[model samples]
Target: MTDWDQTDDVGLMLKKVRGIASDRQLMFFACGCCRLVESKLPAVRYLADRFEKDAERPMSRDEKWSILSAIGSALLGDIHPILRQFLMGQDNDSWTMAAQVASIGRMFEFNGAPESLEAAGPSIPRNSASQAQVLREVVRNPDRNIEFDPRWRTDAVRGIAAAIVESRAWDRLPILADALQDAGCEDDELLQHCRLADHLHRPGCWALEYVRETPERSSPNPGDPV
Candidate 1:
């Protein structure tokens, strides 16, 4: 981190971040680098522009969410417009974009996004239950060195739970919830367990109605309309 902070320019920073041994670590540090280099207003905009202008840019699922997750905490005012542009494409992957929006929407504490998976459906259909099981394994242990130590795995559930939630597959959430319960996740963590109906401002979500609404103590950060 100290080394990254001292080094200058996006080019140098990208080289450094891309060189990180772990993809997850690369994502974590890349986001941090963006923020440290002046809160990523330009960087995020650049990414959005590239994503918009270049229709053929081949980005992996991991790369897409890494960008989203890294910027999850960013103020919506700074990124919403470009985000809107990205998510608005009819030919684009709604599932991926929906998951990205869900990540930020949850962190920002709202769901006034421009679109919903319930309306447009998923770009890719997946087995939510099995995916949830895969996620549970990873959350228990994210290490690669433990072959017999019970943490041995080659995949990252990454944020597939968030994607499933954003997809609004209401019926499939219980499968994830069951997995979460089996994995011993409880309380707030459990609340965030792919059941974003509670967090979403969008209606037609069971999670929203299932959990009782309470009085508001404060508003989220301004400039975050989404």
Candidate 2:
């Protein structure tokens, strides 16, 4: 039986976690605990090295939850965002970096800043609409990439549209509708734009007209109004 309470023996257990080939459950538990420990350690250089090494391994469900919980806990206080970024990683594999960005969006929502809400809007992927709503406070930050990359721009646009529709922010509907009309908008993003226009009772001018007039067909969402 692995002793989860043995904080002092974490170094030994981390070695076991690295060596074990078959015991996935134990490996996951050990990795999760190690992540917790890594979050607390002050040595940024060492922690960065460890994060690079461990991030290559697939995180088990338990391990992912553990890390997420740790992030949530850290966000409750005055912990610096830069510190959290260091603990998480500077790359795509760092879920914590995404979480911190999302958390900042939540802060914007609570503070009632619409500009902040718009600024943080594109950080979420299209498949994660529900989560995006929680982080709807987008502000215009000149330093970050608010515009979507062509590769994933469609997904980002659709995701933001879904979040706006869900939030019933009627005032923001025109801005979102305009984004939908961009020549660069993807099919999925166009569909989401149609939905947003329909939801806001402004279907004819921007999205609905475009969908109807354009030869390109969109995937139908059952019972969705035009």
Candidate 3:
């Protein structure tokens, strides 16, 4: 029932995948949503940093609670009200909290004005669409399993994937694709995703997940510099 392309509600899309996506994956989605507004809100950049790090090395529930509480105290006063609402509702289900973060992206754009949503109307839909794209690229599909050859994770593939994950250097994705090819990877979808120019590949990317051999529920460090 949820149209991935047309719907402007990123949260709805995330909701559809709540049962399927891992917590780290949801955090990655939240970080992607936060990055959409990070330039306008520097405080949000810190939030995104923490989320990305958490996505790679997921905290225990108590650790996440403590860290989010600290982050909330430090950031709640500085962000837009919508973002503040999201931070306040961290106890909600992962999809709900992540959807709240996406809502912040949909509603605000900093332009040295208090009430800028009206002026930011055009980008509201654009941000929502972009957030939806992030969700799609990260989750891919609910039932489809990407079969990657274990042999494809040669040293070169591991090195490239590690570097990209550490630096957030997505521009090197194509190079990673080349490494996979050299290692005899035949999965077109997996290889092409690394080569795709327009996609916003992030920390929990399925291709990188494959390289790290992370199960849907496992939270591995993946060499992310926290």
Question: Which candidate ranks first by lDDT, i.e. highest?
Answer: 3
Q: What does the lDDT come to for candidate 2?
A: 0.34
Rank order (by TM-score, best first):
3, 1, 2
**Range of the 10 consecutive residues with the lowest summed lDDT in candidate 2:** 133-142
Tens-digit lDDT string for candidate 3 (1-226): 3365456566567656766676566667767766766666677678767766766664675565454444443334464564455467546545455555565555544233234434434544433567777787777655456776789999999999999988888889999999999999988778878887734687778778778776565242333222
Evaluation by lDDT, superior candidate among 1 and 3: 3
lDDT of 2 by residue, 1-226 (tens): 1242222332232233222212222222323322333334323224333433443356554564444445433442234454344434443222333344333423332432223334434532222232221111111111222243344335444555555444545456555545654535455544443444333332112232232221212223233233
User: Candidate 3: where is the Cα deviation over 4 Å?
Assistant: 1-9, 54-58, 65-76, 79-90, 109-127, 218-226
Model 1 regions lying over 4 Å from their true place: 1-21, 36-41, 48-178, 183-226
Q: TM-scores for all candidates?
A: 0.22, 0.20, 0.72
List per-prediction Cα lDDT, in the order shown: 0.33, 0.34, 0.65
Model 3 TM-score, all chains together: 0.72
Off by more than 4 A, model 2: 1-53, 79-226
| TM-score, candidate number 1 | 0.22
Backbone clashes under 3 angstroms, per model: 2, 11, 0
- Which pairs in model 3 have colliding backbones? none
**Model 1 agreement with the true structure over 115-140: per-residue lDDT tens digits:** 43443233222223222222221121
RMSD of each: 18.6, 20.4, 6.7
